[model samples]
Target: MIHIRKSGRDDASGLAAIWRDSVLATHDFLSRDDFIEIEKLVCEQYLPKAEIWIAVEDGRPVGFMGMTESHIDSLFIAPDQHGKGIGRQMIAHARALAGILTVDVNEQNVQAVRFYRHMGFVETGRSPTDDQGRPYPLVHMRLGEQRPTDD
Candidate 1:
């Protein structure tokens, strides 16, 4: 059985390990250096601001998902854990915390795009580039029904 729980600073190493492994397994996308950078940035800044959740199976952390008020900072599962509903569970948890949840998927990450679509997040818009002028295409997605309170 998989159990989900909040992660604290002690979980940083676990999160970093998961992040590196996942990125390396996707050799079609991230280079090792890029994954390292992401691991550092997420652990140092993003995860701290967000609610970080870890999926533990038999006492071992197998996946994690992080969310802030306006965005899903990260969602990653072990390579062996894909297609096992962990991602869905994480998304559901994030949605429960916010009336509307948002996330950005790189245009090049086709698997992630499909996964987000399956979770009912729509392509509301796109961003042109990364702050450093890298031409990375970002697809924005939002969840929840439209309400009169939407702004």
Candidate 2:
């Protein structure tokens, strides 16, 4: 079973590697220069600012997610760890913590778009260019509000 927990500075390196590897596996459309720049920013800047969470399997770090009050800034899994439900676990935690989950995913990433839609997030908006102003398009999604359950 995968365990989920808050991350600290010590987990930075592992998180960075997962980010790099995941992007490499799925974001092949990005140019080498853009990819390197994004990798640098994610490792050196964004990861530390976001409320980071790690998913560990067999005592090893396998996936992570970063969120803020209004957005899920990042979510990545070790390439070897895909199809293992780690992403679903992380998204469940994000929904509980953030209350509302909003995420921007590259439109070219069909698997990710399908995954988010499957998780109850619907496309609320779109941008012609990604956050970095690159040619890649972005699909913005938001989860539908949940109804309260009786006690």
Candidate 3:
């Protein structure tokens, strides 16, 4: 059975690998150089943050989610694990911890946008560019109407 648990310092490498592979599979919109830069930040800075969780299946890590307060900063599952409901389980875990979950998904990623929608997240707004001012747009979404953020 798959389980969600707090990530440890030792999980950084595994999580980075999952993030890299998952992004390469689903985020084709990203430029090659952009993907490289993002991976560096993820390995060197982001995964060190404590509010992260991992999905373990049969003694191996397959996915992870990074959060801050109620916002899901990132969520990625190994490409091979895509259809196994791991992402749904991860989001449920986040909701349990934060009450409600918010996420910013790449607007160009139709699958991710649809996935979040089916998971009960609704779009609140859109940004012309990502947080770093990259040309990639973000679709901001939140779960239902609980504690909504004014868009």
Candidate 4:
């Protein structure tokens, strides 16, 4: 059986590997250079403020996810484990911890957009251009509308 658990310091390398693999696997939209830059960005900006989780099967990590108070920052599952529902479990685990979850998915990433839609996350709106002049649409979503958890 697969289990979702909080990621510890030791899991950083595994998460990094999974992130790298995911970027490479999705090269149709994300280039190799983009992957390198984003990996560095994720290490610097996204890691510290967010909480990480791992999906384990018989003590081996197969997937990973990260979250901040304002967003479901990152979710990456090993390519081989994609259809096994690890991603869904990871999202549910994050939801349990933080009821209101959000994410900014690339508009061109059709698979991600469909996945988020299946998960019940609606698109709030687009984001402003950064210093680089790239305007990426931001999809904001909340898990529970009635009562958000304090934890």
Candidate 5:
């Protein structure tokens, strides 16, 4: 059975792998050089500094989320695990811990935008460029007061 748990020092590589695979699958808008640069940053910097929660199954990490207080810095599910309710579970976990949850989804990723909306997150703002000042836009969303059932 899959479960959510706090990440450990050893889980960094696995989480990074999940991030790479998920990005390759969902972030098709990223250029090759951009992807490489981001991958290095995610592995070498972000993963080490962020507070993370991981979705583990059979002793391995299948997905991971990086969070800061009530804000979700990043959420990535393994490409093979998409549509399997892992993301939903992670979001629920985050909400329980943080009370109010927030996330920034890439505007180019229609799937992610739709998923967040389905999870009861409403868009609050937008940024023309990502944190790195890239051309990719971001849709900032926050969870509503009423939680939606996973239908």
Candidate 6:
């Protein structure tokens, strides 16, 4: 059985590995050099500063999420563990914590967009680049709120 828990300092390496594997599985649009650069940032910067949650099964972390306030900064499940409801469980947990939730997903990551839509998130806007000013576009979404209608 999988359970959600807060991460510890010791879990950083394991979680970074999961991040690497999950990105390789899902983020096919990333260039090789970009992947390596992002991996370093994740390991050396982002993961350390963010509030993270882990999905553990059998005492091992199989997935993780990073959140800031009501926004979901990142979420990744072990590639081998996909379609097993771990992502869903983590989103549910985040909703419980933050009330309303928001997330920005890469436009190229169709699978993640579909999952968020299935969880009732609606597109609020779009950006021409990701947070890091990369060329990957982002689809901004919000849950538990009515989508804005153009006047």
- Residue 68: error of model 6 in Å? 0.4
lDDT per residue, candidate 1, 108-149, as tens digits? 778888999988889999888643445667788888674464
In terms of TM-score, the best-performing candidate is 5
Q: Rank the candidates by TM-score, best first.
A: 5, 6, 3, 2, 1, 4
Residue-by-residue lDDT tens digits, candidate 6, 89-133:
999999999989999999999999999999899999999999889
After the best TM-score superposition of candidate 4, give how far the Cα of residue 49 lies from its true spot, in angstroms.
6.0
Per-model TM against the reference: 0.83, 0.92, 0.93, 0.80, 0.95, 0.94
**Model 1: which ten-residue window has the lowest total lDDT?**
26-35
Candidate 4 displacement at residue 90 in angstroms: 1.3
Q: Which of 1 and 3 is ahead in TM-score? A: 3
How accurate locally, in lDDT, is each candidate? 0.79, 0.89, 0.90, 0.72, 0.93, 0.94
Instruction: Estimate, for each residue in 51-134, the C-alpha lDDT of model 3 and write its tens digit.
Output: 788999998999999899899999999999998999999988888888778999999888899999988999999999998999
Poorest lDDT segment (10 consecutive residues) of candidate 3 = 142-151
lDDT (tens digit, per residue) of candidate 5 on 1-151: 7899998899899999999999989999999999999999999999988999999999889999999999999999999999999999999999999988999999999999999999889999999999999999999999958946698
Cα deviation at 73, candidate 2, in Å, is: 0.6
The predicted structure with the larger lDDT, 1 or 2, is: 2
Model 2 Cα lDDT, one tens digit per residue, 1-151: 9899989878888899999989999988889999989988988898877788899988789999887775888889899988989999999988888788899999998888888998889999999998778999999999868768698
Q: How far is candidate 3 from the true structure (C-alpha RMSD, Å)?
A: 4.4
Candidates ranked by lDDT: 6, 5, 3, 2, 1, 4
Cα deviation in Å at residue 15, candidate 6?
0.6
Candidate 1, backbone clash total:
0
Give the Cα error of residue 107 in candidate 2, in Å: 0.6
Runs of candidate 6 exceeding 4 Å displacement: 145-151
Models, CA RMSD each: 4.5, 2.6, 4.4, 4.7, 1.8, 4.3
State each candidate's clash count: 0, 0, 0, 0, 0, 0
Candidate 4 contains a number of clashing pairs equal to: 0
lDDT of 1 at 16: 74
